[model samples]
Target chain A: MTDIQININNKTYPTATQPSIANLKLSLNSNEFICLVGPSGCGKTTLLNIIAGLDNDYDGEILVGQQHTHPKIGYIFQNPRLLPWRTVRENIELVLGEHQSPDVIDALLEVMQLTQAQQVYPERLSLGMSRRVSIIRAFAIDPEVLLMDEPFVSLDAPTARQVRELLVKLWQQRPHTVLFVTHDLREAIALADRLIFLSASPMQAVSEIIVPIARSDRGNELAIESFRQQLLQNHPEIKQLL
Target chain B: MINLKRFLSTLSLLVFLGIWQGVAVYLNSNTLPTPEAVAKVFWLGCVSGQLPFHLGVTLLRLVVSFSVAMLLGCAIGIVLGRNKKLDAFFDNWLVIFLNIPALVTIILCYVWFGLVESAAILAVVINKLPNVIVTIREGTRALDQDLLDMARCYHFGKRKTLIHVIWPQLHPFVMGATRSGLALIWKIILVVELLGRSNGMGYQLHLFFQLFDVASILAYTVAFVAVIQLIELLILKPLDKKALRWRR
Candidate 1:
């Protein structure tokens, strides 16, 4: 993996209309699975959007590596955003572009654990299934950076745990630079190599913690619980949610 | 063997024809000739190639006018759908055009361009264009904004985005517009041909009306209506099903 560092320099917004992440500065490096954890309205999603180049209203220089090549980011949105008119496979292939093979399709479906539902339309799939499709679509492109904003926010508890484990496994396979944004401390602790905790709205990075657990330990509730408890004491807001 | 439902429907149609024949027999005049006599006149017109000639003329006009109008409408619709500023500028014009009486437009075209085939064709195009544009433009408006952003993030080129993203989303809208436009254009073309053109099914139907030949009039109407239904069922329906295959 090539070493890429993103620098957000003095990114500020007007007090009246600004989202959080105003005047926030952070740099992410190669092979970093960084999670941004914060309260709602903390501009976690806004930051992800800006980094993905979907939002350009910020005041900062976003650099990838040493140069300014517009970073190729795979963004898995909060909602699946699958075209209602496309089947599950076709929706995933939309990101893979045309000229994909049947093998690639079967592999992605298998990875996402959606092999049986490839031919099904988006409306027929459950919310969890649709979100899983969206994740695999993002990963299929093998983007330089993966930017996911609360990608599993809508799933039920057991389903969310399954998806969280799937995400960690996929992240391990590729080891691409990841900037995952979510409010769940357990989720952050489970998946992130490094966790960036942010304050309330008009947010700034309050603390940065490196997760010391092995990638294989992601789904172990006891190990994840220990880490969650540590994070809860440091960030009182996270404790309130727990 | 005919199904009972179909036979009953056929019987109703025959009863309606009998009432027409009875009325004509009671009048016993050239202005209200009997159905059998009108049927014979219609048969003679068909065999003598008069009806075919008129049908060919009307079909040629429909093909030329509908093709040009749909092409132009789809182009404008896609453009206006992609660009909000363009949609805002032309939306009012489309609304006014859809609201206008097709006959008034035909008369205006006749006066402006003279009593020519071009004038009649232009009238039919004008009547159909607004519906196509409105339907397609609305489809474009409902486009997935996030998918577009994903395409941008992936550096998908203009051609790729159109083929993969925009075209798939906008297809149903384009088809809906085309069907609605075709349905409107068929009737409007008849009026345009009757008032402005010197030949075509509509002109012949006008001739039959003047001579009070109801069977020939009905015969021409049935033939053209059947053609429209055939085009829709055989051509448009198949195309629609192929394009919407992803729909359950």
Candidate 2:
């Protein structure tokens, strides 16, 4: 894995009232957990869309690793976004393609605690369960770059925490460059190796701070909050962006 | 609960048959034959192979025209739905076709193409295609973009994306078209047959009507209605079950 370099001069959406993204430059290091923290409606999702090659209308360049092209991408949208017709196992298996059997999915489903829901369709799943399936689907493909857009935003507390732990565990096992976008600073501090704060419309990175806490101690909620407090005190410039 | 529903259904059908028989006996005329007279005619027609032959011919026409219309409509609908400029250009044409009467199209196809089998089939398909296109076009417009994005990010190829992501979203609309199309196309096919074709249920019905054989006409009608009812039971119900299995 290598760093993902994103350089955008201007991105004006035809439908948007304001400029979408302008003069945004970001570097996500190889196999590292990078979180982008910004206020809601700040065009973070649009940026992720551009990086994932869903919206190519933007005037920008996204380099996955060293190559100026999309590598395999695993994206988790803000909502669960699972296909309602497909069962949980089938949803993950779909990404594996035709040649590969679903044998690999068994272990991952076990890890995500979704083995029981393998045959259950998305409609029957709880939001939390559906989110886990989405996570599993992304991980199933073994993507080179993973992009997540506020995946844990609306879930209940315990469920979100559990999914976060599951995501960290998955990343620990198969390390890849992750560009996680969210407005929750505490959540970002809890998960990131480095946190990048972004400004409002025409999004540009305002501040970049390396999380001081070790990955080993990130599970401690109190420690994460204290570290966030200390980091905010040291750098008051990002407070406004947050 | 299922058994109770079945019992009620049987009772209603029996009551209907009894009322029809009672009316026929009260009238005591060949114009309004008893249920038994119609039943004998139906059995004789079946045994003599005339009813089966005409029914089979009509069914073949229904299948061919329905398949062609649905395939053409769905393809055109997707194209119109995805391309805004093309849709704008073609919107007036679709509106014109939608408003054109089925009888007019059948008559025109017969007049222009002559009383050939292809002309008859073409007429049914022409009458049915616009409705399917409009229904499927609306469905395509309403598709969830988030799911589409998910499909794109995962690199589901065009074929996989169409089958897994696109088709399920369009299934309800397609089903709507299919049921309505089946209802409509068969009626148009019968008219096509009555106007020009030498065989099929419509031709047979015309022959019965000319002879003033009410029993034979009712027999043929009963056979056609039974086939439709059978189609509802055997084909549509199971397909509906499969499509909606994902729902709660």
Candidate 3:
């Protein structure tokens, strides 16, 4: 928490007639995996987009450390959004931006367990495989902060659970500041060091719950459920939304 | 080990030829030659070197015209596809050219440029360019915006985005243009050559028509049709397969 990496101060986004996010304030520290949990249309995705610099039409001071400019962001969308013509390997290598070595790509593919699907195009890949590739593609660029928007929403339960565990493990090793967005409370409880839950339309920071469970405690279902129960008790609004 | 489907298709073709021969026999028509009569004239023409000379001339005209059309079409299509302003500017021009009859354009080319070889080829090129441009521009417009955003976020510069993203979408469109352009331009080239030029398969057909040699005309038509089918099978199909391997 001491190594503050990114700060968003009083960010307000106007879309159509309503403000998408109003007076939003949040800061992410280095190597901390923060989960943004909220109901549908909660501006969780919108906030993540702002941090990624995808939508710049917002009133805010988004600073990387003390700098006024936005940091280089790596984004993993809900849908993989992989190039259909490019093979899985080529898709991942795309993020390398021509300066990276073949070895770097090989290592990343190996980490993501996508070595076999290297020659396969995105359309050929299953939902889980494509999502894994998408995540690795985002991570490969070595971004300052990784922004994921319900990246595992399409996967089945078991696959999602496995991926969630793998993601935390990956974070533990390489340790980039992560802002993961999802609607699943169990998922939020499992991966998040701190979880920020937002209400429905015209969303604000409704509540922030710090999960006392360590990253190592992830994948222990009983511990995870207990943590979820504790969070529900502590944050009554989040409980009511669920 | 005889494949019934293959055997039946072949039998159908033979039966159709027999029926045509029967029609020729019944009508005793000078204009509509029988299969055997056409075969004889075709063999004779080939043996006498006349067919080869005319075939070469036709091939040359097609190659020239198709090449010009491909170059012009690809350049214009890509520009119109990528640039909105250019697309808007050229929208009416494309519509006008596309609607104008090929024969009308051919006559205009003849009137404008005289009986020159370039004139005939230019006619074919102009005839095919509009359709190619429209197809490719539509494909370019249908390109996925998400992939573009992904490339932007990764800071993939112009060259990389083009090669990786834009090219994949454009490749299919280009292949489509090539197929349609080749198909259309070849036939149009033949028409222009037959009407205006002194040499080519079309010119030979015209000469045969003057002599009332129906067999020779049939032979030339069959020969040209075979050439087109061969190009489709040998070149375009294989290229299409390679280009669209990702689809599989």
Which predicted model would earn the best lDDT? 2
- If ranked by lDDT, best first, what sequence of candidates would result? 2, 3, 1
Residue B81 of model 3: what lDDT?
A: 81
Using DockQ, give the best candidate's number. 2
Q: Rate the local accuracy (lDDT) of all candidates.
A: 0.80, 0.89, 0.81
What DockQ, between 0 and 1, does each candidate earn? Answer: 0.51, 0.86, 0.68
Clashing residue pairs for model 2:
none
lDDT of 2 by residue, A1-242 (tens): 34678898888889877678999998777788899998888899888888889889878788866688976788988898898999988888888977776777998888888889899999998888888888888888877778998998789999999999998988888788899998888999999989999998778888888998988999888998898889889889878877
How should the candidates be ordered by DockQ, best one leading?
Answer: 2, 3, 1
Report residue A31 deviation for candidate 2 (angstroms): 0.6
Candidate 3 wrongly placed segments (more than 4 Å): A1-15, A56-61, A66-70, A240-242, B1-5, B82-85, B170-172
By TM-score, the candidates rank as 2, 3, 1
DockQ of model 1, rounded to 2 decimals = 0.51
TM-score of each: 0.87, 0.96, 0.89
The alpha-carbon RMSD over the true interface for every model, in angstroms, is 2.1, 0.7, 1.1
Comparing only chain B with the true structure, the TM-scores of all models are 0.82, 0.96, 0.89
Q: TM-scores of the first chain across all predictions?
A: 0.88, 0.95, 0.92
Docking class of 1: medium
- TM-score: model 2 vs. ground truth: 0.96
- Tens-digit lDDT track for model 3 on A1-242? 43434334434544367666776667777777888887777677778777777777776677666777777788989888998878888887878856767676677677777888899988888898888888888878888888899988978898987777667666676789888888888888888888887766566777887888866677788998987887778767787555
Per-candidate clashes come to: 0, 0, 0
Q: How many backbone clashes does candidate 2 have?
A: 0
